[model samples]
Target chain A: MDELMEVLRRALPKVNWETDQALVDDGIIDSMDVVSVISEITDEYDIEIPSEEMEPENFNSVQAIYEMIQRLTEE
Target chain B: MQSIVEAVAAHARALPEKFCIADSRRELSYRGYWECISGYAAHLRDLGVGVGDRVVVRNGQNLDTVTAGLAIQLLGAVFVPVEKNAADTRILEIIEAVEACCYIAAKPMELSCPWEKLGDVLSFRDESADFETFPYPGGADTAEILFTTGTTGKSKGIELTHRNVVAVAENVIDGVEMKKDNVEVIPVPLSHSHGLRRYYGNMLNGSSVIILDGVIFYKKLFERMETFHATAMDLVPTALSALFRLSGDRLGDYRDQLEYVQLGSAPIPQQDREHLCRLLPNTRLYNFYGTTESGCSCILDFNAMKDKKNCIGRPTCNAHFIFTDEEGQKIEATEERPGFLACAGDMNMKGYYQSPQLNAETIRNGYIQTKDLSYMGEDGLIYMLGRQDDVIVTGGSKVAPDEIEDAAMQFPGIADCGCIPVDHPLLGKEPKLFVSMERGAAFDPAAIFQFLKDRLEAYKVPKQIEQMDEIPRTYNGKLQRKKLLELEAARAAERSES
Candidate 1:
């Protein structure tokens, strides 16, 4: 989860990841952005972000993204 | 001579039973349409409306607004249609600018200065025999005053004469091959040129017209089209984008019945066009380019889609175009140089209502100088390059935001994006990119920045990327760059406070 937060901080430094819930709702990370981030996470952690796992809830925050990555890689 | 009343009368004489207009409430035949128009004309005459007078029409997309527009023309009064329940400021501005003799509201309500509810103002108690007859006003008489979007600044009332309106309708019919059997479903706002022209074009040919109030109801719109067996339809790019995103099965069903689709107001993206073609192979797609000042400048047919997707095609019949540089010197069609587009034709409006300064700036000699930038292709087709006002100047080099936005939309995970010029003390003005992503997508700012860096010049790449839920849009669905700038400014202020 800390690794995911670090990655998000590098990607979007302007956003206050702690309080700004708009990361997803405000269309900041659009579909293409999500796809790009999934690929980046896959490349970084050597874990694939499957199409089925792509959901808004799974990408709500840095912690969620990290946990999802861990679960996919472990499986 | 080219008044809408005369046009309707001729059609009524030939095909009284033909479908003229189909609204949410009712469908009126040719004879019924003429009778209603005559009834409304008599009501206007009773209110002392005559040639050179203006009648403000405040109504949603209903049968009343259509008939009221025809009636205004029949009575030789300029029809000034403001959107129903518009802001008091906008309504007052329109009423005052046009010097409207009487304002007609769709619902029953008293308004300031000679305003009356349409229902109360016009009597519909079968007074057909007692209705007064209004003769058609000759050409050169003002027919309507349509307010421009005012995106550049203040909204200006564009005065379109009877000849101008009729000529545009004729040109559009000729260009698109609109027939009497054609049923045009209009989904744009009645206050804008797209809706008004589509309605009038069908009426001119005695073709059927269907009016849909709210355009966001795509499912309902598709159902209504199927129920009515509509042949043709007019829409803006935003509506087309929504329709493009629908499931293939649903799109297939609608495509099977549709004859042709027309898009205007903004340029339709190439991806949307290809998607539409794949879904509706038989239906012809046309992109119409025009402004409130110059009605319909050009019509890009489906065939032109092959060579260049963004080409707005050539000028319609009875219209001539010229490309002028910043120094106002005419430039020939070339690969590198793009210039401001100007047009001279019968479809062009007389001038802005009561604004000589705006009139002088826009209309010169015989041409209406369109502020849009475009370059002509070898095929003689015009390719629009974003608006001149929206051009971003950074480090003495001019960059169009559309090119950057277009490139960004192609990038994976980027749902939509807009580029705006942010104030930079050193560079004077720098480009800033604001992007929106689809739900559930993870975004990497570094990856996006790198992707854009590879695709665009160093200066063109946004110095900062701001993620947004949705890009702000104008009422017509065009990108609201000015509002986006405001959003960026507000964010900067918040950051400074912190």
Candidate 2:
């Protein structure tokens, strides 16, 4: 979880993310940011984040992103 | 010589049943669109929105907003369309600039300034309402005031006359070969000149338009395109690049159906242009060069000028372009001497709204000096260097970031990239390359620099290169080099303090 937060912090330097913040709804992040996050997570975790899994639900929050990574890694 | 409003009314009478504007919810026919425009005009008249009054219309890319614009013009009032999410401060600035009488919004915009909701505005809609249709105060009358993107400074309100709007729409019709049967998918905000002109062009030609707004929903956008059997698309370079990223080879699937694709507003990498050319060989791919103030002056038809895809082709329609030096003396178009591209044409703007100082500086002797730096080749094609302000002076040599960005984009792993001038102790300012690699592609600085070195002169190569997760851009996808420079400066300040 610490590593995930660290990766996200480096990827999105400007964003002050709350664990349960509505990233998309609040306009805290955008699609381009999502692309960058996906790339960094894939590179770090060595897990392929499929296009279908690229949804706001999995990426809307820090905790949501972490859970998505855990699920992808376990799979 | 009719105004766009007049032309639209003509279309309404000529093709009453034809679909004019549409979104996911429902579509409006020409007759319906005209009635709504008339209704909105009558309502605005009741609200004291008289001829030549400025009305700010908020809520972007909606059917009501579109109708309200025509309605405002139909009553001879000037409409100012702004982005829905624009800061209240910015909106206030615009209202002060124009001394706007009333604002038409979708809902209460939480603004101190008075505003009327679209619901209330439409409730007073009357189809049979009779108003002074004109003495058609459109030709020289200010029809719309579109604000500049303000990448460098405060946004300037560009006052476009009805004649300017009509000329620009006609230019689009001629340049892109728009027809009555064409259905163009427009995702660009209605607030900007680029998107609004496309809407007008389609309406003038009695064609259909699909309005899609917000972030790039690649799957949904393409799905809507397929559903509409959309014959055309107008977008910025970023959106096209995003589509390429999302669709990849599948983009070729729309090649047969899509008659043409127009890319404009910013300089796109030449490699991306060529990639698109190869991908959609059958579809007419155009890289148009124009500004909000000047309208579209040049268009490069990649299908026709495959050998010279780097150049923004000869002036289109009534546009006349001349390259000039710093003193504004005309410089002969030559490969060796790149100069600021200035334009004089029917489509040129009247002036910035309420800004005589800026107007005097920009619109001098009828030719508006653009920020674009370009030189005409021996073949008479204009090759764009980049923005004049974006030119980097490094070690006594000049470097255009467009050239560097073009070379960088050709690199296999590069997904997106931009170049900005960094302050140096001795050499003054040197360009530092900021790059975003392709998804899953490894970031290797040495290899990338090597690739750049092979393609460019030693002086043109950036002194430093850094890989970023994303490159910042304006809402319309223009590279925010100034912002990037500020970020780097802040980072340096932090480094020293630590």
TM-score of each: 0.79, 0.84
> In candidate 2, how many Å is residue B174 off?
1.9
Off by over 4 Å in 1: A1-75, B108-110, B119-132, B243-249, B269-271, B302-309, B393-398, B422-430, B450-463, B486-498
Candidate with best TM-score: 2
Per-model chain B TM-scores are: 0.90, 0.92
lDDT of 2 by residue, B350-446 (tens): 9988789989899878999977778888777788777778888888777888789889999998977899888888888888999999779998889
Docking quality of model 1: it rates as incorrect
**Superposed model 2: Cα runs more than 4 Å off:** A1-75, B110-113, B119-135, B394-396, B422-430, B438-440, B487-498
* Model 2 CA lDDT for position B326: 88
Best by lDDT: 2
lDDT of 2 by residue, A30-58 (tens): 56567778879989999987655655667
Q: How well is candidate 2 docked (DockQ)?
A: 0.14
Reference A-B contact fraction recovered by candidate 2: 0.11
